[model samples]
Each structure stands twice: as structure tokens, then as C-alpha cells.
Target: MDCDLICNFKKCRKRLNANAWVSIRKDIFCDDDGSREFNKSTTCPACQTSLSGTYDIIRVDLQQSEKYKTMVLAGQKPETVIDIASRALAFWTYQITQERTYQEFVTNKGKERNIQMEQYYEQILARTAAELTALKTQLAATKKELESVKKKYTEATEQILDKGRQYQKLQMLYDALRRKCITPLTFDMGDAPVHMPNRNPSNFDLTLSTRDSILRRENNVSVSTTVPRSPAEREFLLTPGPTPLPPTISDECPAAQSRFHLHIETPNRAMSRPH
Candidate 1:
């Protein structure tokens, strides 16, 4: 087939050049009869292309079917079409494989993030628990200290109250003793006796002589003597046996007599009074 003629035919039919054809004729001679004959062309009449020489044009036409006509009219170039088809199939297969790999990677990353979040939450819980325990310990210690302080205050208050009671008791005793010491006295002063005589005597006579005798006898007698002396004997020895009276004893001499009387009265009075 001529390439130019095929190109012209494709433009007219709006089809590919590869599918165009042409026809040819064959001549034959018989040896005995010496006759010559020409065979008709069995190739395609429009494209002038030959068949495989196994069948007539009528049989080929019957086998060709509508599928071959559609394939020719689609304008496919043989070599270029093969390369484009192979690349398209390979690219689709690669895209399917990459999609599966990307899905697996995203799942793994999600799991790692979940684990990290769980660990962080656990750490926060542990720290919070420790702090609460420490605070409880401190509170217990403070309570014990407060109880000790309250006990001490109670003891001190009791001691002070006891001392105050003792002081009150002492004060009561002091007041009682003071009342007893200063209580008023109640004696009978009207019955007491007077020592001085009611009237002074003028006589310095026998009564005076007798009192002098008795006083002298009492002075001479021992305190331990058991026997009492007769009054006459006591008078006989104590009187100076009527010796002459001193000039001071005379009644006419008033000054001398007064002096003698005073001396005699004082001695007798002191002796006659209680020992």
C-alpha cells in the first residue's frame, strides 16, 4: 500500500492509516493446450490490500464482523497506544498500595498519642495524692500540740485556785485570835478594901507600948519554931523592963511625941499586915 494514499483515505473516512488496504492480480498458463488466462484480484478493492490467500473475498467479508470496523475507526496508533495503556494500569495499582500504607501509619500515631495522654494523667494523680497525705499529717501534729497546751492551762488554773483557798483560811484564823486578845475585862471594883485609917489618933499611951513589945518578940522569934510563946512572957522580954522613957516619949513635948508616934505606927502597921 502507498502511505500517501492511505493518509488521504484516512482523512476522508476520519480513521487510522494502519487499517487501509489495496488489491493485486495473478496470471497462469496451461502447458499442453498452450492457453493463457488471468485470475481476478482477491485483495481488498478500496485499500488494495491482500488477504492471507486462504479464502475468497466473499468469505473474508462474512468473517470480518462489526467489531473490526469499530476498532479501525477509533484512530488508535499501534505503538503509542501500547505504551500509554501500560503506564495507566501501573499508576492505578501503585495508588491503591500507597493508600493502605498511609492508613496504617495514621492508626499507629493515634495509639501513641493516647498512651502519652494516659501517662500524663497518672502523674498528675500521683502528685495530688502525695500532697493530700502530707497535709493530713501536718493537721494531726497540730491537733496534738493544741491538746498539750490545753492540759497545761488546766493544771495551772487548778494550782492558782488551791492557793487562793489557803489564803482565805489563814485570814479567818487571824481575825479570830485578834477578837479574843482585845475582849473587855469585867472585875468588881466596889468590894475592894481601903488601907488608910478613917481618923488620926492623939494618944501615944499603953497601947503603943504593947504594940512595940509584940513587934520586938516577932523579930527575935525563929520562923521554924513549933511552940507558941505565952503573951505575958513575950511582953516581959520585949518591953525594956520599964526603963526611963526617952524625952521624945513625953506627952508635953508635942513635936518629940509626934516623931516617936510616927515611927511606932509605921513599924506596927507593916508587921501586922500580911507577910
Candidate 2:
């Protein structure tokens, strides 16, 4: 009936006899029934560590000592071989337990690291996507601005071309005026005639007078029969039929009546002249 109990602590495998075992208890109150019950735990006496039901103790029977000695025959007795085997068994069990715990610790640490790496990569991808979206918006805005600028430039260019064409037309008109290529038309003044004799063609001067002015200044009439420098001053006489002229009247003067005669200047003689 003699037996040895091994401590469950892998690092502290203290052995105990059957006499060292004790029952630890606590009384708990159940609120539903208002009843009391005893809660029990079996613990190691030397280490004071709580032991699970399956790992509480390792028991070795002293009755099997003779068989262990026959298997390990080195002049060793039965009790010595049993003692060596019990310690060896406890040691190998501790080694296996410690190895399993270390492997679990390593596995949990690797799982945490993988979770952290995955979160970091997700954050980077999200940031990259946001930046790409912003760049696309900016690119679209820039393209629209470029199109607007192009439209404005096109309108301004068309306006400039139109102004250039207008300037060309004005330049042509100015050239025609300078060359005197265009002629003005002529018109008749009245039935009365004035005289201007012994006058130089360069110094000849003419004035526009109404019918009343010519009739009032009959004797002192000064008419100039000078050609116009440019035809812009004359008005055109566009009639449907030929105009008839009155007969020339004879008047005697002391100055030069016999020398030269002044007559009414008609539009026919003016139009018949060469340019």
C-alpha cells in the first residue's frame, strides 16, 4: 500500500507521501435556493499550486520494485532502480509539457504579428486609392480649364481676322481717293450768268451763290470759270432727258465786252471734258 506522489509543477517536481494530502474547502451561498454548499480544490502541499484533476499527481507503486531491478541489472537493488525510474519519468513528462507550452507561445505571437501586418497593408491601400481619386478630379478640372482657354483664344483670333479685313477695305478706299480714280458729278446753278475776264487759271477762285445773290449784284457780278482741283466738290446731274439752254444775250461793257464773252457754264460741257 506504500506509494509516492509527484508534484504537478514541471519545474518543481517535489514528491509527497500520502500523509501530506489535504482537502481545501469553501462554503458558497446560492441565491436562488438560499442554500449553502461546499466547494473543494485539491492543491499541491509543497508548491501551493492548484492542480487540475488529470494532472494532480503521478503515483508509483513500491510493489513493482523487484521487477524494475531485474530489468536494470547493474548490481543495483530493486528500490534504487525504482527510485531512478520514477525521477526519470517525472523529468521526461516535464520536458514534454514545457516543450508544448513554448510551442503554443510562439504560435500565438506569430498570429498577432500577422494581424498587425494585415491592418497596416489595408491602411496603405486605402490611402493610395484616395490619392488616385483626388488626382483624377484635379486632372479633369485641368482639362476643362484648358478647353475653356482654347475656346476664348479661338474667338479672339476670329475677331482679329475680321478687324484685319475691315482695315484692308479702308486702305483700298484711301488708295482710290489718292489716285483720283473716282469723279464727282456736276449740276447747274441758275439762268443768270456772270463774267470773269483777264484772270490767271492758277489764281482763279469760285464761290457758291444763290439765285437772289446773283440777281441783286447784277452789274458788279464776279463769276469765276475755274476748273475744280478734285471732282468731290461737284454734285451729279442725272436727268432722264437732255437739258436745253437759253439763247446767249448781248451786253456791252466798257472794260472788255469786245475782247471776250462769258456764258452760262452748262453740265454738258463739263461732262464732255476729259479727266
TM agreement with the true structure for every prediction: 0.32, 0.39
Q: Which residue ranges in model 1 land beyond 4 Å of their true spot?
A: 1-104, 181-275
Evaluated at residue 158, the lDDT of candidate 2 is 97
The collision pairs in model 1 are 21-47, 21-48, 21-49, 22-47, 22-48, 22-49, 23-48
Candidate 2 minimal-lDDT segment of 10 residues: 28-37
Encode model 2's per-residue lDDT on 205-265: one tens digit a residue: 4456754454445423322223344333232222456533422334643223322333444
| Model 1 C-alpha lDDT per residue in residues 1-275, reported as the tens digit of each score | 11111111212322222322221221111211111111354444334556445432211121356888677436778776777677645544443444455557778898898899889988988998998899999999999999998999999989999888767655555554344333332122222333445334343233545645654554356333345444433433223465433343566765444433433345456445553
TM-score, cand. 2:
0.39
| Models, CA RMSD each | 36.2, 17.0
TM-score leader: 2
Instruction: Candidate 2: give the clashing pairs.
Output: 185-235
The residue ranges of model 2 lying beyond 4 angstroms of the native Cα positions read 1-73, 77-83, 181-208, 211-275
Model 1 clash tally, residue pairs? 7
